[model samples]
Every structure is written in structure tokens, then in C-alpha cells.
Target: MDDSTIRLALERHWAASDAGDFTAEHDIYAEGAVLDYPQSGERIRGRANIRQSRLVQPNTKRFKVRRIIGTGDLWVTEYVLTYDGAPSYTVSIMEFRDGLVVYETQYFADPFVPAPSRADLVERPGTEAP
Candidate 1:
């Protein structure tokens, strides 16, 4: 997909999420797409799994895209999510093929620092557990 197309797709996804429209989201995600939320310890594989997993909480808020950078089939975006609590920063990396997102990975950017010093993944309960 082109840069604009990818941006539109992401915007539509977030719009549907904020509006609580799962059907719309189903159409946007690729058939085999996967979603990983480390903070929530949720890892969903395939569009169907993602379709079933929706944030229905009344207080879960919206995200504003700050920037989107692309190179070839890879697209990266930085965004801010505002909810009941403090806002959070997120970065999304997506790989597109045949004008559709074939792979995607997102990382929490705010209040989340890697290396230096921190607890290991083993200490985390469900996510690291085999």
C-alpha cells in the first residue's frame, strides 16, 4: 500500500476502535494479521482472533497519530493515546505486501525503557509463561 493508504487504514482502525465497531475493524485487518499487547499480556493471532478481542471498556480512549514514516514495504508510526489515566506513547511498525498489511508489531514508548536496568520478562506472569 502507498503511504497515504497505510495512514488511512490505521486511522480507520482507530476510528472503528473508538466507535466500538468490530465489523469495520474486521475488514481492515489482513486475514492472518497478529496483534500483540505486552502491557496487557495479550497476544492474538489472525484476523479472527483480533476481531474477537476488542476494548469494550467505557473509559478506554482514542489515539492521535503524530508521525508516519515509510520505506518500501515497511511503515512506522508514532502516536499518542489518551484514556482515563495518563496518555501513553506508542510506535507501530508494519510491513505491507500486495497493498495489504501482512505483518505488524507495536511497542509501548512512554514510561517503557529497555536495557540499562529493569525486571526480566520471566518475572512477568502470563506473557512469558510457556
Candidate 2:
């Protein structure tokens, strides 16, 4: 698919998630699509199962898209997912075929404080220099 089309699809997916519309968010997948959570080591096969799994989630979730970079049938979306008021950095890599997502893997990481040892070597962005 073209870049614009892929971007639109991703926008729709994020919008749906932000609105708590699970069905619309899950509709981007094909019938036999696979969704993997690498952090949890869980593989959810089939779009129906994936939808069902999300339906059982207990936390109040919100998504803020940070960046989307992709070409052809492969795309990566970086976003912050806030669950119960705690933000988690997330990356989702999706492989699409025939205009539908066929395979996807997602990674989640919680925010952490910078290591003191790296303070001298690293410059933090969006912060005033000390």
C-alpha cells in the first residue's frame, strides 16, 4: 500500500483506541491475523481472539501517538499508552498484506529515571542544561 494509505489506517486505528472503540481498532486486522506481545511472551492468533483479549482488559487505557514510520507493507508506530494514569512507552510493528494486518508484535516499557552514571555523558532533551 502507499504511504498515505498506511498512515490513514494507522490514524484510524489510534483514533479508535483513543475513543475506546475496540471494534474499530481491531478491524484493521485480517481474519487470521496474529498479535504478539513480546514482553509478556503471549501470542494471540486470529483477529477474533485478539479482539476478545482486549475486551477483557480492566485498565482504563488511552493512547498518544508519538511517531509512525514505515514503508510498503511494514510499519512501526511508537506511542505512549496510559493505563490507569501510568504511562508506558510502546512500539508496535505491523506487517500488512492485502490492506489488512497479517502479523504484529508489540513491546511495552514503563518509564524509568535516568541512571546517575550516565548524567555526565548524556544530554537530556527538552530540559535546561544544569
Candidate 3:
């Protein structure tokens, strides 16, 4: 698939996720897809299993996409995933084959305050720094 096509698919997937539509959310994955969560040391193989893993989660989730960038077979998305109203900054890397995701790995990090020493050098999200 071309970059634009893959980008559209990703947009649809994220939209479905925010809407809690499990079937649509997993549609971008191949039948033998694999999903990895390195922090939790877990790997979910197969589209059904991946969909099932998220299906059981109880938290109300919302996805705010920051950006999606890549070409050909590797794509990366940076987004903020809110669970029960708390935001977790997340990065998802997807490897595709034949226009379907064959492997994906997600990394999540909870928000933290910036160090006091570097306050002058840092700029918060969604703001311009001079």
C-alpha cells in the first residue's frame, strides 16, 4: 500500500479504538499478527488474541493522535492514550506486509513533571517556547 493508504488505515484504526469498536480497531492487523508490550513482558499473537486482550480491559479509553510517520512497511504513531481520564503518552510501531500489520510493539509512559533544574530549557506540550 502507498503511504497515504496506510495512513488512512491507521486513522481508521485509531478512530475505532477511541470509539471502543473492537472489530474495527483490529481490522488493520493480519490474521497472524503479533502485538508486543515490552514493559509488561507480554506478546499477543494472532488477530483474534490481540482483539481479545483489549476487549477485556475495563478502563474507558480515548486516543489523541500526535503524529503518524513512516513509509512502505514500517509505521510509527505517537499518541496520548487516556485510560479512565489519565493520559499516558504512547508510541506504537507497526510493521506491515501486504497492506496489513504483521507485527506491532507499543511503549507507554505515564506523565511526569519536568526536573526543576532543566525547567528553563524545557517547553511543555502544546505551547511555544521563546
Candidate 4:
């Protein structure tokens, strides 16, 4: 698939997610597609597994794509995900075949918050700590 087609597919996928329309998002993936999340050391095989593992989440919200880059059949996107109670930035790499996404891998941001420190959590005198 061309760059524009892949971009359009991602756009539709985000739109579907914002509206909680799982079917629309699911349609973008090819049968038996694979998705790997290296940071989590987890690999989800097939559309069904991906849907259950990646797509389904509590209080799911749309992940907005900040930027997209494509070369040949590969598409990469930087996105901000607002799900559950925390928001995070991540990158996704997609491999497309015949206008459908055949493989996808995501990498979440590292150094997540500069790592919380024990001293930073110390309560001051006569003050309640957060």
C-alpha cells in the first residue's frame, strides 16, 4: 500500500477508537496479523489476539497521532494515548500488505517520568504529603 493509503487507514482507526467503534478499527488489520510490544516483551499473534490484548482496554480513548512517516510498505507514527487514568507517548511501526496492516509493533516512552524519588515523596513538617 502507498503512504497515503496507510495514513488514511490510521486516521480511520483513530476515528473509530474515539467513537468506541471496535469494528471499524478491527477492519484495518489483516487476518492473522501480528503485533509486538517490545517494551512489554509481549507478542500478540492474529487479529483476535491483538484485539483482545491491545485494542481492549478500560476507559479507552482515542490515541492522537502527532506525526507519521512512511517508507515503502512501512509506516511509523508518534502518538499520544489517553487511556485508563494515565496518558503516555508512544511510537508504532506498521507493515502493510494489500492495503491492510499485516504487522505492527509499538514502543512506549522510556524514562516515563524521570523516575520517582523517595526524597521527592518526603512530607514536610505539619504538612500532608501527596
lDDT of 2: 0.93
The 0-to-1 C-alpha lDDT of every candidate, in the order given, reads 0.72, 0.93, 0.96, 0.79
lDDT per residue (tens digit) for residues 64-102 in model 4: 778888877888888877776467788989888888889
**Model 4 alpha-carbon drift over 4 Å, by segment:** 54-56, 110-130
TM-score winner, 1 or 2: 2
Tell me the tens digit of each residue's lDDT in model 2 across 23-112.
999989999999999778999999999999988999999999999999999999999999999999999999999889999999999999
Give the runs in model 3 whose Cα sits over 4 Å from its true position. Answer: none
Q: Pick the candidate with the highest TM-score.
A: 3
Per-residue error for 51 in candidate 1, Å, reads 2.6
Q: By lDDT, who's the top model here?
A: 3
- Candidate 3: the clashing residue pairs are none
TM-score of each: 0.66, 0.92, 0.96, 0.76
The digit string of per-residue lDDT tens for model 1 on 1-130 reads 5667777876787677656677885676678887777677777788877766664445676777787788667888788776766677888787777766667777885655456455553264365647
Which pairs of residues have clashing backbones in candidate 1? Answer: none
Question: What's the ranking of the predictions by lDDT, best on top?
Answer: 3, 2, 4, 1
Which of candidates 3 and 4 reaches a greater TM-score? 3
- Lowest-sum lDDT 10-residue window in model 3: 121-130
